[model samples]
Target: MSLKSTHFHSGLTTHLIRRGSLTMSYPRDPNPTKETFGVGARWDVPAEKVHEVWVGNEGCEYVIGE
Candidate 1:
């Protein structure tokens, strides 16, 4: 399964696979932002430090909030 989130500004969708926890961007436009399109489209964070994955207009962030 996947965890999906939508960006407020771009309205693009970003997802993370529960298996690998890899961040991915699902663009809805022909020309998408760098964070939502391109060859290097996925990112992985250290699971220990990641409180959660946040998908925003700026892209996925490793939430470290307490």
Candidate 2:
């Protein structure tokens, strides 16, 4: 049997490294709706409220009140 290797985009790798200290609990969602707090949201905010305001978003790097 052959082992399959996984690959990540350079940008994604860079992001991971930059945010290495952060604990990424969420999965890599290709389509993170506002309901899930896609990104640029306050960490304390509930995922539901986040989506209510920010819909169709992506890349959650710098969180509020960190």
Candidate 3:
């Protein structure tokens, strides 16, 4: 499926599975940082932090779970 953006709440751990290459972006002090994940990659967001994820590549898909 195609997804544009996902918002993760603070104090909740979120699990992500990538079907293709994608990027997760978050705000920082002076600039925002981005992390890319490849196909079949799994990423876990720490419960203490809030994050926003954005799909960076065309045809990329992401599955998110809490």
Candidate 4:
């Protein structure tokens, strides 16, 4: 199966499910760092956090849902 991937910006609240390994970085913070997520992992990004996502070479797939 082909892997799917997407890029996300800040100012939105949503749920993310990881289909592959990926990294999330908080650029707006004083100390920016990269957080990695594995497959089948659930992540919640609130409107307050200013961040972006980086999909790995293997590709990261996710679904947005309530």
TM-score of each: 0.22, 0.16, 0.57, 0.66
Off by over 4 Å in 2: 1-35, 43-59, 64-66
Weakest 10 consecutive residues, lDDT, candidate 1?
45-54
Candidates, ranked, lDDT: 4, 3, 1, 2
Residue 11 accuracy (lDDT) in model 2: 26
Task: List clashing residue pairs in candidate 1.
Answer: none
Best of the two (2, 4) by TM-score: 4
- The segments of candidate 3 whose C-alpha lies over 4 angstroms from its true place after superposition are 1-6, 14-18, 28-32
| Model 2, residue 20: C-alpha shift (Å) | 16
lDDT of 2 by residue, 1-66 (tens): 122222332222212111212232222456643233333333443332211221122223443321
Which should have the higher lDDT, number 3 or number 4?
4
Runs in model 1 deviating more than 4 A are: 9-20, 31-61, 64-66
Ranking by TM-score: 4, 3, 1, 2
lDDT score, candidate 3, position 43: 71
- Candidate 1's TM-score reads 0.22
Error at 12, model 1, angstroms: 14
Q: Please give the range of 10 consecutive residues that has the lowest summed lDDT in model 2.
A: 12-21
lDDT of 3 by residue, 1-66 (tens): 235565556655545556667777665425878787777787777664645666655566667666
